[model samples]
Target: MTAALSPSESELRETLAQVLPAVRADLEDLVRIPSVYADPARAADVQRSAEAVARLLREAGFAQVDVVSEGGAPAVIAHHPAPPGAPTVLLYAHHDVQPTGDVTAWTSPPFEPTERGERLYARGAADDKAGIAAHLAAFRAHGGAPPVGVTVFVEGEEESGSPSLTRLLHTYRDRLAADAIVIADSANWDVGVPALTVSLRGLADCVVEVRTLGHAVHSGLWGGVAPDALTTLCRLLATLHHPDGSVAVAGLPQGEAADLDYPEERVRAESSLLDGVQQLGTGSVVSRLWNGPAIAVIGIDAPTVAASSNTLVPVARAKVSLRVPPGTDAHAALAALTEHLRSHVGWGAQVTVTGGETGQPCAIDASGPAYDAARSSFRDAWDGTEPVDMGMGGSIPFIAEFVDAFPDAAVLVTGVEDPDTRAHGVDEGLHLAEFERVCLAETLLLARLARG
Candidate 1:
């Protein structure tokens, strides 16, 4: 049997350009839904967002579209059967978003998509809503009749840690099977530089409680003799890192990151690092960001300064977030962290560690025919610029689920976000030009995959 003819780069580019305006319009409509699935009060909005995504999939020429769930937030699934000898591709994105934090802090309303310069700003504009739009753009570019089979999965609760993703994947495993999967929830190297995320840090979190005194007592009565729980908890947290700011955990595993030239100036600018503050860890900037263990005290449960009294609190709790490198077992890292907390708190303070969540890290072997096709597509889309193999410090635990479920499939993590996208932050936005290239790249990827 003969393979399908590949579409020329110019042809794909022209098609994507023609369809981009309507795609942007649809994205604007989607961003306005306020589908913050993490917020219990926004459950109705999440449902509405699912319905809207299903409609878009149907409009994109998917004859079989359904909003299905497994006791979790709604997830939209759509399928286009493969032609003879053609491989199937699964496209993944999420329709949900993080809550609009401090709406007054946003230059524009979080749900109202606003255009500024070359970017569009909204809560989910760049994170995953643009992901859904990019999929639609590829389909429209192919006139809703691509050469290969395609499955679109727009999840509705990724922002909420995807608590039900496992059950949902189990329930709908057969429907999601494909030759290659494109997870459009990562980020690019830069605004004009494309990237394929080859690795991601895993996640482990726990709440540590420290108890010094059995009950609140007068600080003046036993100031130097007895330690307060809050102070003890702070000291324990301080032990998780060294004076050089590197993780001091005894047995957590680490990996080597790609040798990407991420300058300190760029990191400082992007992270908004305060003046004279030294960066943490002891490795290359990218290595520390992507291939090392990191621990941070995210939250502390204690008396507020405004409500404080001269009393030694009986108990204090803190939530710790840990990021482990790719290939490291998250549960083991969590265990190590738990052990460190229990053993390092001196003065015989009662230390109780409760593990919260664990997500396995992903390290892709980015070499295969499907990866070649994607690289070719990206290079063409970016005018001969090669796509970088990058690692994301953030964790997307569901990618490991996809790899486990479809062991034979080649998983590709792609994204529409640039450095300034500010995803999950106040001015979350998508660069329109880079987004166009992303759409074009996906369109070409379908054609190339079918041709082979």
Candidate 2:
């Protein structure tokens, strides 16, 4: 049950309303710069976004700000000392975004921030840019000097698997140490409701090559006798899943049942599934998405229909991504995936699987004082709606690193996106009302922690 809001809470909400316009404007400016870390051409733009975040931190009265890099992508680190006897908190977000694919699919330019009704649309608007803006809003609400100390750590290469994260964390461990940490890279339960991500699925990926033919031959001449590499590769990929779309890979750990019922209608609406398409797997939507193992062929090296000639290809390659639920070892899961692909190539096709990035799944224990404060603050910010503990299907590789680095600190996963935010999709957006609530919640959380 939610308790009544205190007098200070009422004042913070009013302050947030007054400062929201400026915060939204900051988000728009940051979104305008295309900061995609995956593309080498946009590397400078990613640095620009980091500089912009550093400026915002300085403007918000952060005592010390630095743009730190170690031969990879740069990160913005800023610190604000605690008001006597207050605990220090660490805030995490990323400045980089995913590459915009086929911009013609978007209603407006992907980098141009567009506002439609209660949503703000842009490439990075919801994913972590909104997160950066929320941190600024919380700091601005308290006149740039909160009751507790604050450390702002804005990463620059999160979308590209964060290859430099371990090095940066180790180098800056002393500066980033805090009593509590809040990762603003997750999604809310819904528009007006809040959620704390208590568990996250781990990730593993590989590129598999299949060679069925020694050389290309005319389809009309050898189609009947020779098996093309593309066809052979497709058959091998199909063996990873059952006819019902559930993962059929043997020796994988099964996921636990979800406490929340994710309705089919909501999933269809959010995922934008095609008409007449059936939902995959035989379980609740949350269970399949957040807990069970999922496999997808992210990319394939096959000729397009328009550019294809009627010839048997010699080799085909595919990029596969696998998501494992909490309590599963990521390295072991990758081994299982490699073994499954190697044994499933039909007709004695030669197969080679090479593993890529991997991160272990994480489950947070939300029973500490920091968590209690966050729950109370969220309830107050959402007007008596208690926050729910939810599981996320996506992997934040750095979350596990943060857990290992700061074992004593409570890590709270919060965000500004909702069900319809469509992060990393054609038209990514931020729900304006929910964003404001997120800002208010974080501000109140800081206040609550300071009281202790």
Name the best candidate (by TM-score): 1
For candidate 1, write residues 1-452 as lDDT tens digits: 21222456567677888989999999999999999988899999999999999998898899799999888999999999988999999999999999988999999999999999999999999999999999999989988889999999999999988999999888899999899999999999998789999888999999999999989999999889999999998888999988999999988755667778988899999999999999997878888888888898999999999999999988999999999888679999999999999999978999999999999988899899999999988887887788999999899999999999999999999999998899999999899999988998899999988977
User: Candidate 2 overall Cα lDDT vs. reference?
Assistant: 0.91
Q: Would you estimate the TM-scores of all the predictions? A: 0.98, 0.96
The global C-alpha lDDT for each of the candidates, from Candidate 1 onward, is 0.91, 0.91
Q: Candidate 2's residue-wise lDDT over 1-452, tens digit each?
A: 54577887778778888998999999999999899999999989989999999999999899999999977798999999998889999999999999889999999899999999999899999988999999999999988888999999999999988899999999999999999999999998988789999889999999999998888889999988889999999999999999999999886766775578777788888888988999888877887878889999999998888999989988999999999888888999999999999999988899999999899889899888999999988888888898989999899878999999999999999998898888898899889889988999999998899987
Q: Which regions of candidate 1 deviate over 4 angstroms?
A: 1-7
